[model samples]
Target: MAKNMTLLWCTGSCPCWRAMIALEEKNLQGYNHQLLSFDKMEHKSQQVLDINPRGQFPTFKHGDNVVNESYAICFYLESQFKSQGNKLIPDGPEEQALMYQRMFEGLTFYDKLGNVIYYDWYVPEGERHDSALKRNKDALVAELGLWEGYLSKQGSGSFLAGKTFSLADVVVFPTVAFLFRFGLSAGRYPKLEEYYALLKDRPSIKASRPPHWLEGPEEELLLKEI
Candidate 1:
């Protein structure tokens, strides 16, 4: 099965990282993989467009099956290879419910973060308003606070869904890492900081650490104030 899989991804894309981590946690080895350059706009190249019309970072294929969306790819892998690797979905009903909740909630979290991070890129400087940017950042800070509360309720050494790592962790960890990578003040969210620290060394995360991240210094602090 591994031999039949192929993945095309770009470095430092959290969605791409999610797919990479899922494959690693599934212990799916020997799969064909390619690293494209976002700086060169290779993610929008013909090769990626052939499989994914959107020309997304992650164009994954399992035999004839193509799963482009990162979260969908993770879910598909877990469902098809349930017995092959670490069980991502918890066995208990309540745990599974929480995993699903957090996993979907992660989408909102990502959207909020993206609004702030990409504000300048998306909005023209002349049209960009400080008020709008502050609103976006404030929303992100509140989102982070909500996550911190969730983690606090779980106590120390607890995964997003429960004691054991689940699909929730797989889905959300990259966004959290992204926050820290852009200098989301660790002191303000100790629980999130711990979560980031704990998961950074996880085998899957270490193995799939963003290639470019290892080669360069961290980028300018985007969320330093928050």
Candidate 2:
């Protein structure tokens, strides 16, 4: 009811960004936000540990109710503050189901992309498996196309959930953003390219972009151009 929300998150964490976007989307103002650092192990501090034993980022506290995990925090905010700004979960049963389905699909898409990033880029050259890398790259390309197709099916809408920017967009935005950061081009997925451009300037998105991304050099890309 009051502006008593507090968020503890790490920079560049996609899950943390999800909570930040949800808060901004709700137009919930003046909430306390603390930036933690993984490099410094700030999340493992006693204060954070007391609230969240796992010491994970995207820790949320609404008065006395504490919630950790990105999706859980986002859902908690959406359900508790539905009267505020844009409705994230949507109203109808079918639309709600679709939003949930698409949101999880976003996770699958990220897992596919993550495999490529981990094996091809993060792993040492000698340690990386060529067969696995190739498989991941192919899977990433296919996953990107699946999202492109979802956008195409929207016809007039620019968002994945149709007409409005829902939880589906919030869930998928970071994955795509990560792809872009890793030098994947949106050029091949025309519909996704358009949708990508559309979300770039959203107030919540602009506010929630990883701060280090502004200061750091772009990561070396691994996925071949599709």
Candidate 3:
């Protein structure tokens, strides 16, 4: 089943990691995959452009069907191979609702984090303002608080959305890991810290971890204050 699929991805990209983790969770092995270098602008190469017009990392193809969006790729894989491996979608209604909520909320969470982390990269130096950067950082801190509260409410549940690891974790874990990788302090958000530690050793996460992350030191302490 895996032989028909191909993935073009970049290391350390949360979206790219999302697709990789999903594939591993589904136990879909032997898929053709290439690691592109973002530093070299390989994501813009003709190969990715052929599969994804936007030239994004995680240009995924299953047979002739292409799924470029990371979350959509996960959903599609689960729907297409429901019986093949671990069930990502929960069966209970409450858990399903929570899973869907967190899955979409993960987008907003990532956006807030990116706004702060990539502020200087995305904004021209002359156009950048300290106030704007502070606002973005404040937003990310609040967003982390919300997630911490959600996890606290989970009580004994180790996984997001429910007691079992579901699509919510698959979608959100990469972003959370990215934030920590960028040096979000572990002390301020203990629940998130614990969650990260817990998921770090999970088979899928371990197997699909960004290779570059293993080779170098963590990025700047961008969120150390918060």
List lDDT for all candidates, in order: 0.92, 0.81, 0.91
lDDT tens readout by residue for model 2, 125-163: 787777877877888888887887887887744578767
Query: What is the number of backbone collisions in each predicted candidate, taken in the order shown?
Result: 0, 0, 0
Sort all candidates by lDDT, best to worst.
1, 3, 2
For residues 1-226, write the lDDT of model 1, one tens digit per residue. Answer: 4999999999989899999999999999779999999889998999999999998889999999999999999999999999988999999999989999999999999999999888998899799999999999999989999999999999999999998988899989999998988888888989999999989999998999898887865767888898
For 19-66, candidate 3 gives per-residue lDDT tens digits of 988999999988999988999999899999999999899899999999
- Which runs in model 3 stand beyond 4 Å of their true positions? none
TM-score (all chains, Cα) for each model: 0.97, 0.89, 0.97
Question: Which 10-residue window of candidate 1 scores lowest in summed lDDT?
Answer: 212-221
Q: Which candidate would rank higher by lDDT, 2 or 3?
A: 3
